[model samples]
Target: MKIATILGTRPEIIKMAPIIDEISKRNIDQIVLHTGQHYDEEMSDTFFRDLDIRTPDYNIQVGSGTHGKQTGLMMKGIEKVLLDEKPDIVLVQGDTNAVLAGALVASKLHIAIGHVEAGLRSFDMTMPEEINRRAADVCSTMYFIPTAESAINLLAEGYSRKNLFITGNTVVDACFRHLKIAKKRGIKEKSLKELNIDKMDNILTLTMHRAENVDVKERVVGIIEALKELDDADIIFPIHPRTKNTLEKFGLFDELNNLEHVHIIKPLGYLDFLLLTSASTLILTDSGGLQEEAITLSVPSLTLRYNTERPETVTAGGNILVGSDREAIVSNARKILDNKNFADKMKNAINPYGQGDSAKLTVDAIEDYHARGLLDIVAPEDIMNSFKRKMKNIREDISVKDFERKENALVHMVFDGKNMQFPTDELNLNGMVINYDKRE
Candidate 1:
């Protein structure tokens, strides 16, 4: 089956790279659609080159704008592309306008949709990403949840039990792959030394790109004030162009004007950022990807947003939710600094994000879902076994007859965010299996 993968932002592009790579190795036809949500040629091109992903088969050129306008433009442009491509499924990753647009178009066009990074909820509705994720989740044919927590979130939303797959987070998968490649070539270590920083120093990595944080004067000031707390610490901020523009517009540029130590530089490519994250002491950000990346890198973070859809990071102890409140941000930072036990707990905490193989797991889930439909590869007994393994975390006995003709085949896997739900009431959550199919 042909899969058209849609991506618009830098993080989505990075996360999708591994899935695209996995899919191609299987000899499946893959179409890459770039919505141009991010317009920086230097930043965008670096991802394709550094990550070794193919250039887009189609470019929509739907550059930046208000949320409604960008989403609308993507919807129109992506809809036209879908009409021309007519692929079996559309894949989208993370929560971005491109994902919502691609999923909406595919759903309206009667094509199946697969959402990577599905079922993340911050319970805060003000953020556009939360809205985009909710919309995509409602429409997806397959939900590739990055964590068991995310899958639980989907089940709470009343999604289908059959469609949800608790695949590990693809970001971790992609990050580890690039880091591994870099280490194999002796590049990861070199990349860190180039930055004039060591892994031992206390570091606070920061990233902010959302319009809500950048476009408004209050939010911008709040961010600047919090960032100022790191004036004494080694604060590394690889900033996006939009964040720079917002800073300039709000007169927040003077905060870093001729500053000696606050390293505010152009955005780093996927591999460079991964290396930086790997060596950093802590993270401070508004970006969802950074929140997840903190967990992947085993670093602690303080989210600048008041509410988050990805609560797993906080519960996993990888991050703290400080939002934009200036005093609160400063106090929280100080508290975390003084609390060595808390810091060690986070540093040594289990990586709730996923191990390094999430991309492969996500690919396997999509392949199985498709194979079961087309070839009847999963018989009743196999289905029971699969369900037992997925829900109970226990291996179930499968009769030989169940797999007499079943064969796992090579398949291309792409990650996308579109609405897809799988509902299971039997799954025990926190010792309470109360009916959760209606809460999402």
Candidate 2:
């Protein structure tokens, strides 16, 4: 069985590394597709090299554009590839234009769609990612939810229980894998020494790339003011390309650069950033991945966003949502810095994400589904037991029998803003009508 894995952003690359590693180990014929959502080599190519991942088989080079333009171009590009390769399954991770486009095009071709990080919801529809994830879930044939809460979210959204699996977050697997590599390479020690900073110092790791935060001038200024309040602490910020552009556009780059304690540097590779995150005293960011990583490492964190898709981290006492309100941001930072007891409590808190075996479970699920198609290979019942035994934490009621054979179905799709009506009896490729305009 051929598997097509589609990715675009750095976050997607980081999250998908372990799954790619597992697929390679199994000698699966997998193809990697790059959408170029982050087209810069520093942001994209560095990740593949750092993670030791094979170069992408196809690079559409969609790069950056408006939401509609990006997704539209990606959909067109991915559809041609799907037609050429005709893979049995197309896998996409997280909520990006790439995932949405992959899901859309594969659904049109009746290819099996597997969403790696399915069922995540910040419940804030204003965020583009929320819409992308929800829409992708609707078209997915396999849903690999990272937590029980995520599974519950999918079920509540009326997804088929048979399609869902509660594999832990693959970030845990990637973090564990990369952190070991980082330690072996002495990355953390070397990074601190190079930066002229000590590991024991009060360090605030900041990352802000969310469009909602940086795109708005008022919000960006507020965040800067809040950062100024923590001028006494060492701030290590791995500036995202978009964030840097937005800062410059808003005329706040000079102010931020002049901040004595704020050390703004170009984006780091996965190992460097992971090492930096591991050694930080506190993490302040708008990134969802960082929130989870901070929780895994037991570091105190403050999220600049008003809401998070990963609320488990906050409930576990590892992260606080401070938004971009200057007072709130400053207050929370001061609270975490001044209250040693609070920081210690956050450090000791249990990570709700999970221990690192998510990649193995994900690959096992994929292989089990593929093997089910060959009657000459193994009995379905035995395959089910083997999968269950291998992945002990799998839901008790989920069985290998849940895997469905794929065939074309009638689809209702909207091109542009209009719903195109076709003869009802002529249902063929992916019976579901996809409303692309719903995102617009």
Query: Residues 1-440, candidate 2, lDDT per residue (tens digit)?
Result: 88899988888887888999999998989899998888776456656876777889899998888999999999999999889998888999999889999999998787888899898899999888999999899888888888766776775565645567778898888888888877777654344457865444888999998888999999999999998989878998888877898899999999999998988887776787887888888998998888988988778999998899998788888889999999998888888889998879989888777788888898888888778762122223643323211111122322222211211221123122243322122223232223211110
Q: Which tens-of-lDDT digit does each residue in 1-440 have in candidate 1?
A: 77899989877887888889888888788799999978876446655876678888888888889988999999999889889888877899878888889888888887888999999987778767788899999878888887766886776666654577777788787777778765554434343456677544667677877777778889778767776765666777777777788788877886765465577766665666776778777777887887887888788788887778778788877788887888877776766566788777887767776787777776777777666663122224543334211121113432222221232211111111233222233321222212211111
Worst 10 residues of 2 by lDDT: 403-412
Model 2 CA RMSD to the hidden true structure, in angstroms: 11.2
Which pairs in model 2 have colliding backbones? 409-428, 409-430, 409-431, 410-427, 410-431, 412-433
User: Given candidate 1, what's the lDDT at residue 324?
Assistant: 82
lDDT (CA) per prediction: 0.72, 0.78
Error of 1 at 166 (Å): 0.7
* Model 1 segments more than 4 A misplaced: 43-46, 66-69, 181-195, 215-231, 248-251, 335-339, 374-440
TM-score of each: 0.78, 0.80
Q: After superposition, how far is residue 105 of candidate 2 from its true place, in Å?
A: 0.9
